[model samples]
Target: MSFGPFLLLALLEGTVMAAVLALTAVGLSLVFGVMRVVNVAHGEFFMLGAVGAWFITYYLPLPPGLAWLVALIIAPLVVGAIAALADVTILKRLKYDPEATIVATIGLLYILQQAALTFYGPDARPVEPPFSLRLQFPWFGYSGYKLFVVAAAGAILLAVWLFMTRTKAGLVMRATQVDMETARAFGINVDRVYAGTFALGAALAAAAAVLIVPIQQAHYLMGHDPLLLSFIVVIIGGLGSIRGTLIAALLIGLSDGVISMFFSPTLAKIIATLLVAMVLVFRPQGLFGARA
Candidate 1:
């Protein structure tokens, strides 16, 4: 293939990656923004989503399209419920102390990993795409499903944006994010908000996992890369800044995809890490983050 074709392929791949990464990183960013809790187990939630999808499709005696559709609806809800349960049972009890939550979430991460290994097994699993169509470009054809992933993720992000900016529930969440004490004083149930936020974050991760599972097999350990990349995106985008998170995800995803296409994945990671280092050194608040 010519360089132009290769580059075009790389760009499409990168856009797909950015779509998934944006969903995952936005979840991470939302949790930090609202609850000020760094969820180390966030990636595990993502892994669980893929696992959930696999389970749904495997045992459900339905058509492939219907099974995938069901998984898409159910996995996020299941993962979100799990996250909410954890918040209620663990983080809430700990008073959401930043340091304490970090340790707590780390523990949760291990527990979830082990649970997956025990039940889901160590083997990787794949989910069939809901559709199998290709769109022919000038130089090549691409998976219609991949394009759908991009569109679906973009729609979800937009819905989230609308929820946060337009809805009363969103207003309450924003209030809590601004100041929990003040929000509580105004009769907002801060505890419920916290639980909901955690659930929402986990749901976003799960949703992303479901979307990408067809492209990448589900495995117990698959969350590590997404987790690391998410942290990088959140850091570079400015913690809690949704717009920044989306932009940074695109930047990292595109660069990683292009570099991996031409060079090595390891080299791509190195460059991403280097970029993170530079961001930390030069603009610790992130590109779109407000001054502290």
Candidate 2:
């Protein structure tokens, strides 16, 4: 076994996997931090975004890159709209009932899943990289498109961080997350904040799905792995902290990549899950979480 190839593969997977983890977990963090609602249908939104992007790119005679771009931009907006509608119509009504919020999202998850199945069937559909850019990276060669995804995900994450830290909207979001009543008292429209935050979280999930579709393909149930992974990340990172989520995501991504490189992927996943379980038992606030 050539250690060099395995090392390279591990590095590649770690990098991209971290991006995926960040994308998926950030949304979960946002929802938890601000709205205090767990969206069971988050994965379904990811699937919806991927499928929606695929259709636009494939059926519209657009260039492959353009198609993916369309998916990247449009899918998130569409999913965000759906989320906003749900927030206004359902979640808002049950603001005081956390259990009801969970149940409602679970119901939405099933509806979205069934709708995806009915439209795309049960088979997994592969989506090709928009263009062939044979980029040589000194030792590790990769398709130009995968490189694009890596770059795009990184840029998006940076943008999100900036938005959260620098923008007025970000301040408002933080205020809402910390205390809705206080934010409302301060003249911020709490309802608007909740709706916008929910939409933003949904959009983030959708955007991640768009980025991942080329590698994972468009499947009705494609969101399952991401959703599960996101939950694990949030738990490991501390429920509502973006810094914690980012750190834990990197930890999990690197751990999974190295484990898979050394052992079978299946076994690696099992080990990862065990590690998470142990972490939860020992450090319920997460590795990066502040001790409450």
Candidate 3:
């Protein structure tokens, strides 16, 4: 392929990757933003979603599209519930102490991972796309479903932004983030808020997983990259800045796609690491995070 065609393909792949990353990372950002908890298990939630999607599509008698649609709706809910349960049983009991929660979530991560391995097995499984339409480019044909994935992610992100900015529930979450004591003084249930926040974060990861599982595959250990990339995005975009997360995700995604296409995937990752180091040294607050 010529440079133009290759570059176009790279850009397309990068956009898809970015959409998934933003979806997953935003959840992490939300959890830290509101509850001040670092969830090491966030990636496990993503893996769970992929696993859940596989289960749903595999067992259901419906057509591929219908089964995929069902998986999209159900997997995230299941992951969210699991997260809420963990919050109530583990993190809450630890009093949401930052250090303790980190350790607690590390355990949570192992527990979820092992459970997936035990039951879901070690093999990677693919979920067929709901629709298989291909869009014809001048030089190539591209997945219509991939474009839909991008649109779906964009819609979900927009909805999340609206929820945070427009809804009363969002107001409560924001208030809690701003000041837990003040929010509680005004009658917010801090404990419930934390639990819900954690669940929401996990659900977002699951949703992202479900969307991408068709392009990729469901595997027990698939959470590692999403976790690492999401953390990098959170750090670079700012701790709680949604806008920053989106922008950083785009930057990383495009760079990864183009670089990986032009050079090598390992080199792309190394560049990303170097970018993070630069961001840390030059702008410790992150490009979008508020100054501490």
> Can you write out model 2's per-residue Cα lDDT over 131-205, one digit (the tens) per residue?
778777666776677667778878898998899889999999998888888999999999898898888898998
The best candidate by lDDT is: 1
Which segments of model 3 are wrong by more than 4 Å?
A: none
lDDT of each: 0.96, 0.84, 0.93
Could you give candidate 1's per-residue lDDT for residues 1-292 as a string of tens digits?
A: 8998999999999999999999999999999999999999999999999999999999999999999999999999999999999999999999999999999999999999999999999999889999999999988899999999999999999999999999999999999999999999999999999999999999999999999999999999998999989999999999888999999999999988999999999999988888888988899999778888
Candidate 2, backbone clash total: 0
Q: What lDDT score goes with residue 158 in model 2?
A: 92
The lDDT of model 3 is 0.93
Question: Could you give the candidate ranking by TM-score, starting with the highest?
Answer: 1, 3, 2
Residue 250 of model 1, lDDT score: 98
Error of 3 at 253 (Å): 0.8
**What TM-score, to 2 decimals, does candidate 3 have?**
0.97
Listed per model in order, the count of residue pairs whose N, CA or C atoms clash below 3 Å is 0, 0, 0
TM-score of each: 0.98, 0.94, 0.97
Cα misplacement distance, residue 102 of candidate 2 (Å): 2.0
